[model samples]
Target: MKHEFTVTSILEDARKKHDALMVLVEQNASVPFLYMDRDENIRDVLYHLYGWHQILSDLMTKNPIPPIELRPGYTWKNLTELNYKIKKEAESYTLHEVKHLFNQSHNHWMSKIAQLFDHTLNAAGLYPFTAPSNLGEFIHECMGGHYQWAIQTIEFHLGDPYLRPLLEGFKSLPEVEAIVLGGSRGKQQGDHLSDYDIYVYATKPIDVEERRRIIGPHVSLMEYNHQFFETEDDGVLNNGIGIEFIYRNLDDFKAMMERLFNGQVNRGYSTCFLDNLLTTKIIYDKKRAYKSLQDTYRFIDKAALYQQVIRQNIPLLYGTQPNYFDQIVKAVKRQDIIAVNHRLTEYFSLFFDTLFAINQINHPGEKRMLEKALSLPKQPKELEKTVGKVFDNITSGDFLKDLEQLTLDLIKLTK
Candidate 1:
């Protein structure tokens, strides 16, 4: 019988395959299985499968799954490293614990995939920028192909320990009110170059020496007090993972959040801190103060915030005589690349702040912005192309025209 490939079919097949795999796992689970020509066992195979499920689950939670585009952070060439990390992370768990985790992740994947519409499942280019394959094919590869591969490999043969110490050390500090894991990893949208952004909120200064004493042993390279935009201890962990220990004054941060929430707007880079606060994962909370603050500001006045951002930034773009456009025009005339770059930066900053507010999302930080903007449901027509044109013509006479066209296109979204 020819097999059908619908959601129901996928689910049924996945369940049957999972049951078969589990049974086989039970039968020869104790017999060491060489996985991928590595010194790995049956437990390693289960954890490896579980890790993929977890990745898919995270992607599903974020709507319109960004192209798996080579499994989030690692490319095809370096996938072995990702796999190695997955295996290392699961090393500490007992066989029983690993089984439990595997089951949890597998069930979670099924639940999230089931929530999708049939059209979305079969639709092509749903994630166009990277992997143009339809969701159904992707699902089958992860679920069906991977499970089949695991079964065949077991016929022949078959895990991130770092989080614990960091949490424990930070939790011990009396001055630390909350420890948050931010950046791309926290958002689950990390690429290969992403790092661990540990935002440490404290009541008082954490002496540089004290921080070093806690975090130094785990990291091979450490730099204390690099004050570029924030005071942070930047270093690379022994495992070659980059980490930044960003310190923030809890009370001051709270106050700033209040102002942003209450309609205050900056000329540029507005809502960035708000974005950071909302997106970060709470690693440690001394007295739940951080949690309370998050709860309090979690739901903002969207319409009000949207209007405030638009009202504050729209005029700065082009509503006034000699606006940002005019300024950039004059700069380009004088061949002032620096001034042109500066105004362009301010222009795009406010442009993005307005765009994100209109879409009802907090402004995610500075990088991968165009990618993020393109993902938003509400955006100007040909956003990527237009933005690209502006940059392409930055030093030419066409610069102002591109900028004006871009600004006008964006402005129309407001109405």
Candidate 2:
């Protein structure tokens, strides 16, 4: 209820955060969290925070209270647009200038605030623009809120990238039975964008926390179980290496080997597991377990396998518009551009797999799906034309005829 209490409480939180940073400087002098989301450096983030303060400072000097717009012409109403603007403008300012602007703006705003009457701040409808919150509460959010953010940003910059170090330590783990490297890295087709497709096979469930600890404050975000049954996904960049981890328990995998590795049609996962077993180059296998995987998949019933997938999924490929082509039509008519694209994409994906099934081809993962399809022996003759039409999501008569013909051609290949 007291004006002094509101103002003092806000500053106390901000002042505490500032004091903590100063104490941190006494021990370790490394400036914290220079890197932010999607690898945006520290200077850019400061520029964004400082922009808000600068606007508040300008309004307070010209008029006691500011408008909701924050600036005369533009406002932070559209946050995504505001972030875009901040990023573009911040590029023009040096890191030093950003710091100076922030400091100057902070002083000017605080000085102006100190001169205001407690009644002018506390009384509602005084500033008709910011109705619900009078003025002190607004300043609290701008000042103390942003200071806490900067301190946290500094803390986030401390960790290293975690993937490479984690894999390096896997060699010493007593639980791990095999460490096999696969995907482009194993197939000798790896480029800069290629991820680490490493399989860490163990007899029991791999200890996740212990794996994270080996890197020791290096990992910022690590995700698991979304990609596969037992796996971890990390996009955190460290030492310029992008890594993806797959953990397979031998006790669990032994059950899946006959179905997944031997080309038994998996309703959910598809046939790429056979491709992985074929292409993987084992790094460290104490019992040569991966060799058995290769041997099992080597003599597949290619004709029988092709019949299984084609029969199951071909009905999906050749159905009428209400079932097949009409899905895209419904989305396009609704003007749901994302839905239109999604429908087309899902159709194309199923179409690709069906074509491979006809060829009895062990389709690799999505890395070079279309390219791989083009190389196969039993694919549709007008494949490139069909691919272009579907991918473009073009709803013309010629495109329709092309898609229909392609579907008919694929059905023939299956037979």
Candidate 3:
């Protein structure tokens, strides 16, 4: 609601930023890249202004109001990625060609912006699916915002020349909505031999074959059934650092979260998702929506969370014996590896649920569960040793006894 800038104000701000960017171009001879490589910073600022302008013109006639959040057949979600695409496309041309296209794009954008009515520009809920906003705000967001950021980024890169290469490498990747750094590297908890756990968030799910193509020559894909990145492009090795590629669809994630928040979580299918959402680090958030999601789930209804956990997990844990926990013990006595392991995972889920319920904490995820649990308010006795014991000695004769003791310990703690 606060972003209702008039077209005149929009043009003025854009003109100012555009003027500043050109000064850099003029001073640097439009060769901002090292040794005058691709059209560096200014190239993007101009090209994206052109794109926003072009998309707005097209939006006037699309059937059913095309999702303004996205453009057709292309994956440019916001100014950040749109600029990247434009810059890449501009690479073929010399600085002169690049400037020519930019001028054309800029004029095209200005012509449309000049025709917007105040009523259309300032109205709320201009589009149904998006936030309450109008054309003026959208133009300001995509056009002006890109310029403002580009200048800052350009200045920062000038100070730290090393960063531009890394940024460029990241930009080279295709259809990247966001790139999040997670795991030990993300949380800054790694010692040595820590692989880069990079989560690639996209507008759509990239296929296994297409994903393998854009990968940098430095990193090799991890083997299927690899330790960290199990199957389906579990890893890439860059600069001798193991890099894992975790591709997720932002659209799918939002839909899943909507279903879960609306009481669909009783099925217990998305426990891992909740964990990842909380634990992962957002390194590159283009639309800046992920943080809002984290905030939404940051504090949850403990009683309700417990209810979901108990309803879904109790029966599975307490299969046929006096209780699910007891039933697990019997399965262990029968030496059913498959059942024991399956039930063990279910117990982990239930145990995680129980811990979250007792402490009223959001689930951080399945990784480092016992360590994460111990750091919480009240911890069960021998929790650390028992958790390791469960996995290590699942087939051990004392597995059932250990399970019983831990279950009883949980009862005592919650009470």
**Ranking of candidates on lDDT, top first:** 1, 2, 3
TM-score of 2: 0.53
lDDT of 2 at 295: 51
RMSD to true structure for each model, in Å = 11.6, 19.6, 15.1
Spell out the clash pairs found in candidate 2. Answer: 32-154, 33-154, 33-157, 321-326
Per-residue alpha-carbon lDDT of candidate 2 for residues 1-415, written as tens digits (9 for 90 to 100): 5344254565566567645643543343434332223114566656766776765566555654444565555554444445556667888987667767766766666666666666666777665444566667667666777777665554544323344346568767888888766788656567778766777887776676776665435544556445555466564445556656688876566666566535566641266776777677665666766566565565545576667777767666567434556676666667677776776767776777787776766667777888888888778878887777666745443466677777788888866
Tens digit of lDDT per residue, candidate 3, span 291-350?
667656654543666556545555555444455676567677898988888777777777
lDDT of 2: 0.63
The 10-residue segment of model 2 with minimum total lDDT is 30-39
Shift of residue 17 alpha carbon in model 3, Å: 39
> Compared to the true structure, candidate 1 yields what TM-score?
0.67
TM-score of candidate 3 relative to the true fold = 0.51
State which candidate, 2 or 3, has the greater lDDT.
Answer: 2
User: What's each prediction's clash count?
Assistant: 11, 4, 4
Worst 10 residues of 3 by lDDT: 31-40
lDDT of each: 0.76, 0.63, 0.61
Among all candidates shown, the one with the greatest TM-score:
1
